[model samples]
Target: MKSSGKRGTRSFGAVELLPTWHWSQFTFFTMVDHNGNESSAPYFILIGLPGLERAQFWLAFPLCSLYLIAVLGNLTIIYIVRTEHSLHEPMYIFLCMLSGLDVLISTSSMPKMMAIFWFNSTTIQFDACLLQMFAIHSLSGMESTVLLAMAFDRYVAICHPLRHATVLTLPRVAKIGMAAVVRGAALMAPLPVFIKRLPFCGSNILSHSYCLHQDVMKLACADIHVNIIYGLIVIVSAIGLDSLLISLSYLLILKTVLGLTREAQTKAFGTCVSHVCAVFIFYVPFIGLSMVHRFGTQHDSLLPVIMANIYLLVPPVLNPIVYGVKTKEIRQRILRLFHVTTQTSDP
Candidate 1:
């Protein structure tokens, strides 16, 4: 509902509401400066893929395909895991949560990205921008927590095979999932609020196709020491801690794997191949983006933008593919599902 009626400004109507709230729809306003000057209150011009404006249509095609494949593939994983009685295990359940997170996070950015590349529509309402930032960052933190939970599940399953069922029972896994969500939401709650409260008197042009915390933080006109410190603490306490614990859990898992017979070791370690790939896909780009943001400030702007996009888009696209092709159960179930559909449709 926050928008300016200036000549170049754009207003998104009811279609922009995340969940279609009537009261929050069809309203508009302009920003009032301290000296009684009025300007656009809640608008940002997203400079998507700078210097590549001519290739926007070409860029949209591949990105659109990635978005579709990510959604369909992850949804398929969820459906198979839920419907198949044989897959009602802790690992598949965690995978289902992972898929759901992928869909949620990607949805927050992909729509706006398509709008930018396809329609050349780059104006984003301020509130919607904050919402997108919240969803992307919180869901990213949730992904790390979910991965840590899965690491613990594997640690139990391999190291304490006898106690695996009792330790990671359905209720316990559910509790872990709830804890992950709560922890993420609690830690990331201040991110959007911090960015929102900051005065955006300067250029509101986002560096990428979608809203990201770092991208938005740099645009604030006010002193941002508090926001910077709190954001760092949230990242360290949540994602950093989860990454460290996940590493430790895998170390213990490796120790347990080493104690088994050679054949048993191969079989046991195969279970983690998919997870390791997914971890790398998610973390490598994230870590790279962080490093570049800190150390490569003098480098080309396109590099950071590319890294940030990869940090966001790669995991969702790769998680389902890795799980589907690497995990035997999912692959066989997908084949069987298609086979049944083919037979049913034969006339």
Candidate 2:
């Protein structure tokens, strides 16, 4: 816990925007000082949507539906891939990891948000908040790494078909995934420690329905220069660098694809459509979130809140759908699964 009764006054950086913890509206504001405890852990209140408070109860329906769909869809992908021997290949293995990460990303924040929306349980303990923050950011980083690994898988499969088997062995992919988990965990492990050291003397009222490191750190009365710098470093080194490498991997993939015959080109590119869709949905909101944080010094807008919600929700919901629809193998298997279920139920 890092909050308590009262408020203090302080200003650390430029104005920042606050997004809803779930898919809802929120107002952005600058952090100012208030009088409160220097070291005591303080609880926080979650605001689901700023202007649309009355509708939050109803909004819970859709948000909960989306969460269920996200979880079930991703979990289905994992199950299908695990059970289907044909899908034990490197590509689907990576897809399984992606789905797992998606489940984690959605689960990290959605449950508490549901509580706020449906039950009006807006209060979160400080330690729980820290745990949620770590889960969200670290899982997000792992997803980015998985996406990058997928891009590499596609590159090797298409560009160097002969080496595809050798390059992306099951063991190698497992190693890469383990490395991603390790890297993300190791990098973000310091975040909770950093925030915990600061004294939150400002208003314990958080801008979003969930705890974010940036939002949480903003309430501190003490200097958070280390937090700020280290946060930036983590973003750039992990997600930003992964984005760059994924792009490079695609560039090489495109180069290799272009050398193929017309028919070969179409077939080759089709394999990437699902991945491309996933990449866009995952990164677009991420870019939006980053830009809003970077440039949100002068005004308040819905973009920050909107982007934050989308960043967490869209990828998880869409990845499985895209893969299920675009990839023939997955699509056929899913259909067969449903058909079997229908047949069994009818009897």
User: Which candidate has the top score in TM-score?
Assistant: 1
After superposition, candidate 1 runs with Cα above 4 Å error: 1-41, 298-300
* Candidates' C-alpha lDDT: 0.82, 0.82
Instruction: Please provide TM-scores, in order, for all candidate models, with all chains considered together.
Output: 0.88, 0.88
Pairs in steric clash, model 1: 31-41
Model 2 weakest 10-residue run by lDDT: 14-23
Cα misplacement distance, residue 297 of candidate 2 (Å): 4.6
Cα lDDT tens digits for candidate 1, 1-347? 55544554444542221211122122333444435543434776676676677897798899889889999999999999999999999999999999999999888888888888888787888888888888888899899999988888888888999999989989998998999899888888899888877876545666677887877888777788988799789878987898899899899999989999999999889899998898888889989988877677642378887887788788999999999999999999999999999999999
Model 1 poorest ten-residue lDDT run: 15-24
| Model 2 misplacement above 4 A | 1-37, 297-302
lDDT per residue, candidate 2, 1-347, as tens digits? 23322253224332222222322332223232343123433466676766677998998899889889999999999999999999999999999999999999898899888998888888888889999999988888888889999999999899889999988998999999999899889888899999888776445666666777887887787888999999999989998899999999999999988889999999999999999899899988888877777678632354565677788889999999999999999999999999999999995
Error of 1 at 181 (Å): 1.2
C-alpha displacement of 40 in model 1, angstroms?
8.8
